[model samples]
Target: MSADGGGHLKMYILIRESVPTGFAVLAAAHASLAAYLKFRDAPEVAEWLSGPFYKAVCKVTDEEFEKAKAFEDHVVLTESALGGQEVAIAFKPRREWPKAFRFYRLYRS
Candidate 1:
């Protein structure tokens, strides 16, 4: 689903641009699971699971990654391979998000 598209509930996993591709892949997966586990009881998460369950894996700069932390409905993931640096964030599934979320580019090799 498009980030700005309406209807289906969605989640976003934003990985730092500095992380290597392979590690970024792993970070996205870990971040997804972490967010799901951490917010499994939330109404949005439950509704999301019952519906379309959309997700996006986007790339962001380190500055954007830090800024994402200001949003409360997310889980930040740290990679031990990268000396425990915060590498990614997985946001809880919801119907609405901050406008900046729509501009993050989808991660590509």
Candidate 2:
């Protein structure tokens, strides 16, 4: 819960820069769905799912992706097209945005 009584949960999707735009979109989608399903039963996740369910997609370097993979709350997405390389990482809903991930920028057209 937030000060204004709104849910503070938000999902963060990070796509590896090496991946092409099309593949990146697919990878992020897969990671997001997987994370949502994996945590759907939690109270905070349930509240987030029932309403706005905010999500943000950002670009990350290979090194950053590796670092994010070690987080317990994240899901790493890989595919044959990526030659077994991780294409994206999605984080479970968090009350506050992570400071360590501040360097990444939002996905843009």
Candidate 3:
């Protein structure tokens, strides 16, 4: 653990420029180095975040930010109370994500 007792495991909130309605949360566990992310449609991930297993989400890393291109594995159109829009979230396993190098550190969001 770090001096603050903060493990390498962390959470970040992801909002896509394409779908801005909601946020995606990414979670990394301390011991196992297992990363879990939150997605609206992926009930398993949502359920995991709903429990105490989550460390943090929606965090802006201390390092600089790297912009990612907009890519859609799947898209959905929503009809929420506010308006008709599409929103989605993603959880990334460590293996599935690439090293996001910013100012000095690596980030997933």
TM-score of each: 0.93, 0.85, 0.26
lDDT: which is higher, 2 or 3? 2
Per-residue lDDT of candidate 2, residues 4-88 (tens digit): 2334677889998888999988888898998888877778788778768788798988788788777677777887876898788
Q: What shift in Å separates residue 49 of candidate 2 from its native position after superposition? A: 0.8
Tens digit of per-residue lDDT, candidate 3, span 1-109 = 1312333322333333333223322121211122231233454445544554533222222222223223222122232533643332223311123333121222233
Which lDDT value does model 3 have at 87? 30
> Which pairs of residues clash in candidate 3, taking residues 3 or more apart in a chain or in different chains?
12-58, 13-58, 37-91
User: Where is model 2 more than 4 Å wrong at Cα?
Assistant: 1-7
The runs of at least 3 residues in candidate 1 whose Cα sits more than 4 Å from the true structure, single-residue gaps closed, are 1-3
Predictions in order: lDDT: 0.90, 0.78, 0.29
Candidate 3, residue 65: the lDDT equals: 20
lDDT of 1 by residue, 4-106 (tens): 8786789999999999999999999899899999999999999999979789899999889888889878888999989999999999998777888888999
Candidate 2 clashes between residue pairs 3 or more apart in a chain or in different chains: none
Better of 1 and 3 by lDDT: 1
Best prediction by TM-score? 1
